[model samples]
Target: MGLQNITGLFYPSQTLGGPHIDIEDIITSQNVISRVMHSYLGILVPLGLLAGVICVAILIRNKVKHQTLENLDLHLLALVATDITIVFYSFTSKTRPDYLEVSNLSCGVLSWFFNTSYFFSQYLLVLMILILLILDDSKTSQSHLRYVFLTLTLSIVMSVVNVSLLGTYDNLHNITYCQLDPLNARPEYDFTKFFAGFCVPSLVLLIFVILIIIRAREVEMSEKLQAHGVVLCHVPIMFICRLFYNIMLIRRTGLKINAFYMSPREELVLNIAELAVFSGSCIGLIITLALHKPCRQGLKKSLQFLINKCRGKETSNSVI
Candidate 1:
C-alpha cells in the first residue's frame, strides 16, 4: 500500500524528537533577511538618489534651474525620494516608529509608499519612452496619455481595495513583518479583491512593458533611440528580486504551520532573485547615466563637489 511504503520507507516515519518549527519561524527567518537587505540599501541608496537628484538638477539647470524640472525628471525624482524614504524608515531608522506615533494607521503605510512609488515610476518611465516614440513621428493608435490615465485609474482602485483591510492595526506586528492574516477581517480581504487589487493589474503592467520594449526595437524611427528597451530590461530584473523576496516571505508563512525544508534549487532562486533586484537598480542608474549625457555630466560634477565638501569638513574637524 502507498501508506505502507511511506511508513516503511528507509528511516521510518517515527522519530525520537526535535524542536518543531512553526509559521513564525519561517516568517521570522524570511523577514530577518528581508530587513537586513532593506537596511543595507537604506544606508547606500540615499547617496545614490542624491546623486541622481543632482544629475537631474544639472540636466535642467540651463533651461529651468532648480526651480523646476522636466515632468518626467520630476516624477522620477519623486519616485526615488519616496522609495528611498520608505525603505529607510521601514528598515533602517531606529526611530522609524516615531513616524507612526500619531496612530497605528501606518500599519501598511510603508508598503503603500513603496508600491505607489514603484507604480508611478513605472508609468512615468513608460510615458517617457512613449513620448520618445511619438516625438520621432511614429504612428500610434492609443495615446500615451490615455494609457497613463487608465493605469492610474486601475492602480487607484486597486490600492484602495487593498487598503480596505478591516482589522485592528497592530503596529508591532505590521509593516514588513509577516503574520497570519486577520481571518475575521470583513469583505475587504476577499479573494476577488486580492486578485483585482494586486495581481491582475501588476500582470497587465508587466506585459505592457514587455510589449513596449519589443515594439521599440521593431519600429523604424529616425535615430532608433529605443528607450523602451531599457525599461523592458529594467522591470523584469526588479520584479524578479521583489518576487523572490515575496516568495521567501510566503514560504516562511507555510513553514510556520508545517514542517518542511525547501529544495536547494528553490533557495538559490530566492537569493538570486533578491540580488537581481538590488543590482537592477544599479543597472538602471548606469543606463540612465549612459543614455542621457546631461545626467551623466551632472552626476559627475555633483559627486566631485560633494567629495570636496567632505574633505573640507574633515580638515576643519581635525583642526578643532
Candidate 2:
C-alpha cells in the first residue's frame, strides 16, 4: 500500500529510466496503484493469517495460565488480547468477491475493537500508574474503585461522542483497513470538535504521563526492580503514537496511504508513530511478563509447549 501510494503521489512527467509520473495526473495513477496493491494483498493475506494465529495462541495461553498477574490486571490482559485480534484481522482483511470492495462491517468491527481497547487500556494504565507513583494513602481501595468507574464512564462517553461526531465505523479508507476516520474529514466537519474530542485528550494524557514518569523516577523503591522503567515506557509509546497520528491527520488533507504521499517532516513523524504503535502492545507484554519472575517463567514455558505443538501439526500436515 505504501509503495502504491507513493507511486500515485509522485507522478513524474518524463521518464529518465522509466515512465513519466507527474503529480498533476494523480487520479488515474492512483487507480492503477490501488489495483496493483489490492492484488498484492492476496498473497500477503496467507502469511498474515499464519502470523496472527501464532500471536493468538501465545496470547491465549498467557491469559489462561498467568500466575503472577495482579487480579486487577485481567482487564489489562483482555485489552491486550483484543488489540492483537484487531490488528491481525485488519491486516488480513480481504475484499468481497462480487464488487471487489472490502467488507465495511469487518473493517469497522476491527477498528472499533482497536480504538475501544486503546482508550480503556490507557484509562486503566493511567490509573494504575497514578496509584503506584503517588505516595501512600489509606483509602487506596476506595480511590481505586472511583478511578475505575471514572475511566469506564469516560470510555463510554468518548465512544458515544465518537459515533456522533465521526459518523459510524462505516467511514473508513478503502485501501488501508486500519486507518481512522479523520474528524476534519467528517460530513459536517468541525475543527473544534476534532481537537477537543481526540487531539486535546491525547495531549492531556501525555502531560499526565510525563508527570507520572517524573514522580516515579524521583521516588526510590525498596526492591529496586527495573519494572518501573518498563511500565513507564508503555505509557509514553501510547502518548507519542496518538500525538503523531492525530497531528498528521490534521496536517494532511490528501490521504493516509504510505510514506510516499507525506512531506519529509510528515514522513518522519509517521514512521515514529507506526513503530510506537507496533511496539506498544508486544513490548508492553514483554515488559510486564518479564518484570515478574513467575509470569516470565510461566509464559516462557507455555510458549515453548505451544510452539512444539505447532511444529508437530506442521509435520503431520506435511506427511498427509
> Candidate 1 on 170-285: residue-level lDDT in tens?
34233221111221223343343334533554576666555545655554632444423444444564555555555554553343334454433343344444444444455455
In the range 159-186, model 2's lDDT, one tens digit per residue, is 5454454433343443322243321234
Model 1 misplaced stretches (Cα beyond 4 Å): 1-19, 22-43, 59-75, 89-104, 125-157, 169-202, 209-230, 249-287, 301-320
**Which candidate tops lDDT?**
2
- lDDT minimum window of 10 residues, candidate 2: 9-18
lDDT of each: 0.44, 0.46
Clashing pairs in 1: 22-256, 23-256, 23-257
**Per-candidate TM-score against the hidden true structure:** 0.54, 0.54
CA displacement after TM-score superposition, residue 51 of candidate 1 (Å): 3.0
